[model samples]
Target: MPILKDFRYHAPVGVDEALALLHKSKKPLLLGGGTFVLNTLKKTAAYPTDVIGLRKIASLHGIRDAAKEVTIGSMTTLAEVASSPVVGEHFASLAGAAACVATTPLRHMATIGGNVASRFFWVDLPSVLMALGAKVAWAGDKAKKTLSVEDFLSLTGPEARGIVTEVLLPKSGLTGVYFRHTQTMEVDLPLVAMAFAARRQAGGVKDVRCIVNTTLSRPVRLTGVASYFETKKVTEWKADEAADVLRRDLEQGKLDDYRLHCLCADLESLIDKFKKA
Candidate 1:
């Protein structure tokens, strides 16, 4: 069995206390449910000297719905988000993505904050949140701030170190779909994942956003393909044309041909469903 290296554990009850602990520690790592951090420390040689648990912070534990937006606390578990009626009704794709993460047990333990903060490419939430145009609110010793999900995903090192407080989803009722291609149905990391959102205007797609995450390091928005789709009539859109646009934008040779083909086919199917709706 893998063992976690020696570390001092601190549980802070408030955001200010947590931030103070984080700033004072020599090598502090934030803990939210401890699914990702604990597992990594168990299996990997790298470890932090201090582990600061955020579970004691009461503010980071609930979902709040506003007139124009919905805010989900970072410490809220994947299971909570998956089963939330508000989330399901407003952002079905995000709910679906949350439900599909790992298994029942892991979902119960994996917090949304930990999942987003880790920024693991294989994870499902990041891509769907990005497609939905969500914003992330974070706090640190310096100050609290917010960033677009796209911008948050692109950050690295110190820029991404703050305590993720909540994820804000816009109330705009856009249709979205989340697709994950795994080798088996029995809970495994996806070979390719895609999340797409589009608004229909005058029977044509408008405000389109498509995010793709493969075996690569991070998910990226396929702006070129989204642009192409925006120009075509929803009813007139063809699968082959969509595939060709994705193929060109993705630079065909970088990914395994078969996997890319499957992704393209799935994306076409997703678009077809949107067209029919």
Candidate 2:
């Protein structure tokens, strides 16, 4: 590992300038907090030459609220998101996910954009967002477009020409439960992460979603697990029954046999916790 060769640096003052830089460069990497980039540069063979720092851009680092939804600027720090009163109150699952990310110092320096944009499959936010049915607002060449988190995580799609501007989450009547299984209580990557959100209609489960995050290529949705509870009484929740159904519903080879077994049990535990909580 060695220092990266001297390359041009662009610290755009605002979003327009940032977009211009992106449009002009053939290959430009957006630099938010630079936590992962800097580390990789030092320890790995992956390092980009042209770095476009978004830290100075004020417009890309705030939160906004409207009558129907909440918009979170892409460059906002994870720490800021964790402490956002609006986020904590309305999107408790998201806030909790942000708070549990890395650590106090890392969270303070890790931007939401970089965290979400990383290629790592175990990153927590995307799964939670997908489960929440959140949408990401992207600005590009032809025109701005928005994609649901699930779509954004798709394996093949149109390459986003510009950048992710903000994340929009609809205001809904739902409660969220997030569970991460780690090797220890200290800072460590999650072995398995589960997020569940349910909307109660007349005191019964009306809508439910579950997302499982791992080190694989992409997050996995336990559609079988979710479908089992739909239109059923929440009071009759049974972990063992759901696990049996999930074993038969999900793809047979998505995970290794050992991991598949563990994750199934984790999902069951998550459902039990949600029921108790």
Candidate 3:
């Protein structure tokens, strides 16, 4: 571990106390389980002196379901989320994704809010959350605000001006799947991932969303892929046609032919399985 200079640490018991500390502190960093932050500290010179731990705040934990939405408190652990019957029964994809994170020991120590707040391109939760159209509710410097997951991740880093309080996911007719591809069963992070959330429509596909997460940058929405499925029958589809279309239009320009071909192949296989399900 790196040597750190002496600094004040604060543990606030409520949202009001936490917000007040955030407003008053300079260059303060919020501490959840410290899985990421602490690891970074040991490897690099970066460490926050003013740490404001959110663990003391009873309000910022657990999963709760209302009639219309499911709310996950900011400090809720990944293990807790994975074990939640509400998540498993109602949000299978979310539960599966949480259960797959790191491992059981790490999941027990990590928080869902911390996972999303990392906003790392390689992380799986953000992409899955994007497909679910989750919204983040936080206490901003000026006032409380809620922003779409997309908007929240667009910040330079985690929002320094706000303390993320909860994540709200709308409940309704939505189906989702998360696929992680890696070279090894464990240890290796996902080389490429595909996440999808969509609603079946009477005529065809409705409200389809596709996201791609890479280790290079933040997770990106594959909107172009989703567009091809609109009004198209899920059963009768051409993977080649979809691949060719996406290959030509990606904003990143033409990917290496070999890599693109492999990605398309995986995509086709996954979609076929989803269609059958």
Rank by lDDT (best first): 1, 3, 2
Which runs in model 3 stand beyond 4 Å of their true positions?
A: 43-46, 157-159, 249-262
Q: Which run of 10 residues does model 1 get worst, by summed lDDT?
A: 38-47
> Which pairs, if any, clash in model 3?
none
- How well does model 1 score by local distance difference test? 0.86
Q: Can you give the TM-score per candidate against the true fold?
A: 0.94, 0.90, 0.90
48-118 per-residue lDDT for model 3 (tens digits) = 55788999898899899989999999999989988999888767778888888887788898998888877
Alpha carbon RMSD to native, model 1 = 1.6
Each model's lDDT? 0.86, 0.77, 0.78
- Candidate 1 vs candidate 2, lDDT winner: 1
Per-residue alpha-carbon lDDT of model 1 for 10-74, expressed as tens digits? 99899888888888888888999888787678776557888899998999998999999999999
